[model samples]
Target: MKSLKLMALATLFSTGLHAQDRVKGFVYHDVNNNGRRDGKETGISKVAVSNGVQVTLTDEKGWYELPVGKDNGIFVIKPRGYKVPLNRDNLPKFYYLHKPQGSPATLEFKGVKPTGPLPESVDFALLPQQETDDYTALIFGDPQPYTARELEFFEKGIIREVAGIKGVAFGLSLGDLVGNDLNLHQPYIKAVKKIGLPWYNLIGNHDMNFDVKTDSLSDETYEANFGPANYAFNYGKVHYIILDDVLYPNPRSGKGYLGGFRKDQLDFVENDLKFVDKDKLVVLAFHIPLEHRNGDTFRSEDRQRLFDLLKDFPNTLSLSAHMHTQSQIFYGTAEGWRQEQPHHEYNAGTTSGDWYSGQLNEQGVPAATMRDGTPKGYAFIHFKGSQYVIDYKVAGKDKSYQIEVFHPKVVGHGKNTRAGIYANFFMGHQTNLVECRIDDGKWQKMTPVSAADPAYLAELHPWDTSEELLAGRRPTNATDSPHLWRTAIATDLPIGTHSIEVRAKDRYGRIHTQKSTYRIEKAKEL
Candidate 1:
């Protein structure tokens, strides 16, 4: 238990000292809720532990040994039916930082200080908790607040609606927890904790320490706030892996950052999966999308390596949020995926939509609708066994308000309409079945178009073309909305109010129906 001299593991390895070669650990049941193993406390068997890359399971006596080849982290993966201790920020403290020499000294944000020496017996304690296969997790993306005022706007605009929400097992924010201002980390945590659930966070590109010269030290502040930037945990039948995939000081550009993973991260995935069941749903959550419109933002080799690691796992899904837009991207054989079933990556919609722009609504919060016409909202991923379905919830709106139907409110009597009816199914994909019907008539298939959402354009127009200054900033110009569907309707129907109903079946086979009323009137009345 004595502290060894402060020395990097690499230096010691070169000098032929193998003090840090192996990590011996015990996974014990914390009967009294204490974090230490007592005389009567029993060790838990078959528990998985890891040294970042290599994974090992506890023996019958709850003992495990993982080889720590270099300066690597050692942590326990919380098994199902067991709960790890949580820190003050409600973050699960299931891992211990193993940087003997600590982080590099020059980084602006401080990382873990020198821990001196490896412990004789590194132990993990867990309390028992009952979990259900059918549970929902609250998912938020890019709650990136820049200032205290913007933080307040985030609280009032998004968090206000889901405060103290029930029926959710836990919550996850898909990175970009704060804007460039790292000081807002605590404030962001304070606001999100109001939901009263265990929360996990992914380190975003904006969350990195830009002052750091290399990508390895980029996450010092993030790691200081949240535990390990990359770690894994289990709940019910699912194994959730949270990774820090942002590589700062872009290797190609030598500035800013790139979206990808390090070799150790891929190795961690390979090692961790060794102990996981093939049938269990493996979920990976991170910040940058694997593929961006500008092309593949992440390195192709890293993605291929990840896909290779996930080849055996039949049920897997990755969640990302950086584009500030909501869309579903599937990677198949063309993307180097080995399995016949393509990997599904959900590029989540941001809570801070369009950098929190647009005019303020009656609630005094910015409209902040994303450029794609998707509202500033969060999502709920419902999981049952190894299968899952996602539902996006627009802040301050009812759950049933899933589709935004755009059409003219009125049309001239007996005249053919030039404008077509557009439906922006916020959680839709091209493969989804989108159809529209008029006044109980037969449904007509809607065409998928890669065009801007007219509704979002209309939302931005009032501010863009304003004669006077508006209360809030103008929203960004509309971009191609991937989820938009359109179908033309004839205004030749008799003069009266008509209902246009839109029906969509998502990839998961969940059907959603929404209707809007449009009127036909005489020319004189118009």
Candidate 2:
């Protein structure tokens, strides 16, 4: 056969151009123009295809090459929108192992036993998405931790729960793979690889370092850690687009820290989907929530055009993190999303539930429950043909029913306020304020709210009982740990400008100050 490049050039021109021979193959959108890989049929074009060190874009035919090595290699780069299957260890589906007959080998995964036999082909299939079927996609907000110990709070439990539990075609985590410290990316990647399923990443607000200067500061560090931060892969009959939606406007001096996709990547998405079936479903995953950040005043202007573009797809389920709590939302011309209800619109839950804060359960697991009733856990999704279905399995105890929290809007600014003291808004509004005294002013004892409200247990799951859903908040302990939000009181100092100092004692014996501002507005204003 003539070289792929010669063939490509011959088919289109009079001059001969050599094919960049590495491994010539392609990934295409299986547009259901009915059972055939036709010439005129479109392919997933211009997506990134890499061979570990080098990266390139697939030509118009969705065809690509990266100097294939018969040994120690296979095809893999972010497949654009689709998700990749992670092994029980959580490593990606794209990797090559070159072992010389019975030589002691160093494994990429710490515990991945010798895979034994390598497969003949490592190809991924992408379905042209027209619309989603009877399915939904589960979304996680964030699981940012400043330290390694925190990753344990995630792996010891939630990581264990997700193994082989493959009902959904794929899964995703909102950004903040590590805190601002980029070094954690490797360990975090190695840790989550345990689930052993196809997964993708979303860029988030917390995923960047505000210290760097320039938009091009290159998340190359992030890229090396998580494989081209913005790439794609395929899963159960759908074209899932995983984007490095976070643009670090400046890393050196710190400038464009706002979260959104770049013009080039967005252009790639539009071009990549050229072969996608317009009527099929589209699964978009990134770190920053596409919706307004918790309380932003206007819709992101950048997303408006993207949203308009998304309308072309019959069904689209966009998942994001950043809020560090569980939230759900729907866009498009859908009725449920168009209407305003806390339940139908918001961010997804975080992986750590609350930065791995609070006391351990009877099982010695960190109590990771979101204020919205969901606890620290990963979402499960089932994708068949062109549809997706989502279900959340919270970490901690094995739950068969959805949790439900009943409480009125928080009242009064004092930690003693009824709702403020008992409400587990650790996932919504962080209300950890200190209560101080004026005399020789001894900071007295107070009721500190636990991120995982031990008492915040849902009296009943959403199925057994009903309640309004609210937006999610992130896990605290960003710098350290939020410890425990002990006990407190109002000090009853005639509602006006008053101040107080607060402290909390944790189950781990760690103590922290709850010193922050508090306004004693009329309770009726709640």
In model 1, where do residues sit more than 4 Å from their true spots?
1-21, 69-71, 292-296, 524-526
Over all chains combined, what TM-score does candidate 2 have?
Answer: 0.55
* Reference-based lDDT, each prediction: 0.86, 0.50
Q: What would the TM-scores of all predictions be?
A: 0.93, 0.55
lDDT (10s digit) by residue, model 1, range 208-297: 889877776788777667767888999999999989999988888888788898876786788788889999999999999887434447
Worst 10 residues of 1 by lDDT: 1-10
Q: Report the C-alpha displacement of residue 269, candidate 1, in angstroms.
A: 0.5
Point out where model 2 deviates above 4 Å: 1-90, 93-140, 166-169, 209-211, 250-256, 293-299, 332-346, 371-373, 405-526
Cα lDDT tens digits for candidate 2, 1-526: 5699676555222211122234555655545533335555566776665443335677886877654332223344444344334445454645443222222233221212233443433333354332434444445457676677777766776677665654444457767777766666767777766666555565455555444443332443443344445555544456666776666663223455556655545654665566566766677777766665532422365565566556556666777666655544545443223323221233566777756654566646566555444566766656666555455556654544332222223235433554433222222222334333422267654443434543344422332344654222223422211223434434354565444444433222333332333445554542
Candidate 2 residue 340 Cα shift, in angstroms, is 16
What are the root-mean-square deviations of the candidates from the true structure over C-alphas? 4.5, 15.1
